[model samples]
Target: MIKILICFSVIFSSGIGLNLYATHHQPVNESNALDLAANSKSAILIERDTGEVLFNKNAQEVLPPASMTKIMTLLLVMEELENGKLQLSEKVRISEKAASMGGSQIFLEPGEEMTVNDLLKGVAVASGNDASVALAERIAGSEEAFVEMMNQRAKQLHLKNTLFQNPTGLPAENHYSTAEDMALLAKELLKYDEITKYTSIYEDYLRKGQENEFWLVNTNKLVKFYEGVDGLKTGFTNEAKYCLTATAEKDGMRVIAVVMGADSTKNRNSDVSAMLDYAYSKYTTKSLFDKNQQVTSFNWLKADQQKVNVITNDSISILHKKAEDLTGIETDVKIDQDISLPIKKGTAIGKLEVKKDGKVISETDLVIEEDMDKAGTFQLMGRILRSFLNK
Candidate 1:
């Protein structure tokens, strides 16, 4: 590792800005927003692209997540798939502990084998506790270890209001999360849009042409009843009552709404629907850059190809009240820390901040477009000779 100091390398250009928003580290304040939740104890709505708050009511209050804990479980599973640690086509064997998961399960038997794709369906659509534990075991070798990974991931995301004691979100002491945390978790999960293909399913079958063919139905009713509502998860237990974290995209703007501690499924779905209605009717977003859009390029003396493109990990957008005008836009690019050769494909190189009137309104991490390897001795020598000749 060479000593290198790179910070605020340039001020790039993007578009759209008016009001400002702090990053997730600071709570979003959508003042003057409507009270969309009539029955839920705590609820929140945020634009997915910018993570700007659209509505809020006791969003930080911690409570039982119930099956919504599967959001974190799904996130880790998605991450493992992305990292090539797990494959959708690969099969995971069910352990006795996994098959023992009782509440809201797909009825996996001990020693049964299921593909990762089907297990994902089981968790996302059926809220199968058995599937969750099976995947947890496959990823971390055990459910207990997977729970630790959940806590570590929560801390990495800067979720101050979440603490996980189990992967199934089963009733346990010290197992709690907030509307804000679950919404953020859903946002993270949405980064892999492929998940919606499963969560959006209203009904499906687990076993094909078998005597014990089991039917699977999505616990989230809004996926079918509500237009543009694709997913998320629903939760229910004696202690937690009813809960939901829903995501919907309409006319280019995607939003996440979370309703927890509702009295009934009707109230839970209504709270989420009301929040989504408020968001789409009141808010819009301006796309600044597509995913993987190049922000800038710089040379690294140590790499085989010195010139590397810096791009965003996700699409960049600016959230706006539908009635407001867009103006006062400024973009700043900052190299977060030391930069050297041998960078990974998705490693954060810095951050891009969209500002309005000197305050940051939107922020996203900048990443290396692809992996880079250090130059060999011959390549370095040839570069030195070329520099000497040019001079």
Candidate 2:
């Protein structure tokens, strides 16, 4: 994660007078926002790109996550795929324990073989407990070891209100998480594009040719009915109640909404829908700068490269209330740091501060655009003599 330092200052710029340095940490005032009076026990809405919380209620209240815990399962699978430790075409032999899962499952029989791809589909679209456990065993050698990996990942992600007892989210003491924690997990899950391919499917057949073909219907109904709602998970257990972590993207903005411990499925859907609606209606995001764009150029005091261009490797997006005025926003570049000889191409030289109406909204590190070599010995001596003569 990139650490952003946000500080406010009043600055003057050409064409824009009295520019504002807007800090991204400033919370949006909720006075004029819609009254979410959501019925779910805990809920939150956040911008996917910026991780800004738009609305939340009791989001840290830990409760049974049910199958929503599978988001981490999917995340770990995606990571393994990216790292080449796992392949989609590889076959997994179902374990007797995995075949015995009781809750939502693909009904795998012991010793039956399935590809990692289909198992992913079963878990993502069908919420298959058997598939989840099978993949868990395949990834970490055993379900218990996989749970350890899951908890380790959660700790690395800084999730404070979470604990996992099983890969299928089966009801067990101490198996719980908060809405906020689940939303964060969903945010991480969305980073892998491969996930959406499976999660967005409304219905598909698992065993296409066999006589006992299993049809998989998405547990998340909103994927079929709600526009832009492609993914996430739904959970329900006698002890957990109804839970959902719904994510949607419209235009260029994406938002994640999580609802936990709702009294009914209707209430969960309604609350998650309301949160999405609030996010779309009240907030907006803009791509302020594209990745690798040269933001500015500066003189290199002692390097072989006479000049260095400050560049950004990641795109910068600003999120704000839809009603706020954006015309007066401006950016301020700060470069008080020293430049040394032999600077690397991606070395951080300074920072670009984005301001809205004179307050710092966001900031990104400015890096050296290209590699710089040290000045030759003769050139360094000549420059030293020239500097002394000039002085």
Candidate 3:
């Protein structure tokens, strides 16, 4: 028989052993104009560095996504690649169903063979519908099953306003996503930097050996037209009109803009570009607090130490206007009056709430930074005597 032993340690900050506990809260403000006079039915601009919404217009309304559906498909495929379930060098034979896919294709022939790397390039840079379908078939044995996986992933990501009817975001009656949902999906996709290696390519060649070399150009023009513009996806259809999900990184600031139902391709591109500019120009990242920094000191009762230092668990940063003075900001460290013994390390014992001119700006968790061993009987008695004597 094996006995399981559970040993808990109480952590303190700056060599002090005391218990602390509290709640943390913060208030955020969003004030940016990226949706200026755009006829787009829905739009959103978000700061990629922090999941903050900079501007939004009818963002939650689910509308036809068109080719934008490929974003989620690419995300799942990248996840599979990272998990070792799929490899870029692996070859997938095109099936009849994949070859039959119409609208924006790399012209894959049935029984034609291509490496997963080329297919991913086709889908990411060229927005090739045929490549998307072929990859889907290879992953799930059928397009329908792959679509189901997309829906399941959507639920897992909490994209409530999204539904996928196809692996490639072609025009489908039931397939739709809101501007807000698309932004969320884009944020999640950015976690995997591997996708950018292909999305940022402006032009490339495919099928070099087969007598008919194919030239591929990225559908998202910003990759070549704008500076610091990397990726996302572009979409268009009679019903969905012109849509674009553009991502840009500059001066350490990253932003994602989603526009849907634009009247023309030019307006869609302009709207997304303007949104990115507004976010990068108007806001900047500021480090408010750091982890394991001493926030305050607390008095202990019947303990070996009379006082303990409180600290934070993680560093916190906030996006604010450049004109704002962060040094003048006031921080209030709140903790429980009393904490029990046998406390564990890394416990959230309190919070450090920073405010600017009475308005709370950011809050971070104050945790125990070091472990505190349990006091023995004699130690406890000595602490009690000390407490009484100090009184």
As for TM-score, the candidate ahead, 1 or 2, is 1
Alpha-carbon shift of residue 212 in model 2 (angstroms): 1.9
Clashing pairs in 3: 10-372, 11-370, 20-349, 21-349
RMSD of each: 2.2, 6.4, 10.1
Residue-wise C-alpha lDDT for candidate 2, range 1-391, written one tens digit per residue = 1222333333333222221222332224562254663678877777765566777677789899999989999999998997789999999999999999998999999999999999999999989999999999999999999999999999987899999998889899999999889988997788776688899999999889998799999989899888999999999999889999999989788889888888888778888887788778876777766767987775544667666677874456667666665554567767644455566777776777776555665667777778888778787788889889999
Please give, for residues 1-391, the per-residue lDDT of candidate 1 as tens digits: 5343344523335334444464643434554356578799998888888887777888899999999999999999999999999999999999999999989999999999999999999999999999999999999998999999999999998889999988887899999999989988998999998999999999999987898788999999999999999999999988999999999999998899999999999989988988888778877888887888998887777788878888988988887777776665667877755777777899998888877766776688989888988999999898999889999
Ordered from best to worst lDDT, the candidate numbers read 1, 2, 3
Q: Which residue runs of candidate 2 sit more than 4 Å off their true CA positions?
A: 1-27, 31-34, 289-315, 327-391
Best of the two (1, 3) by lDDT: 1
- Tens digits of per-residue lDDT for model 3, 132-213: 9999988888999999999999998789999999988887778999998898799778877778899999999998766868
The model with the greatest lDDT is 1
TM-score of each: 0.94, 0.76, 0.71
Give the count of colliding residue pairs in each prediction: 0, 12, 4
Candidate 2, residue 130: Cα displacement in angstroms equals 0.7
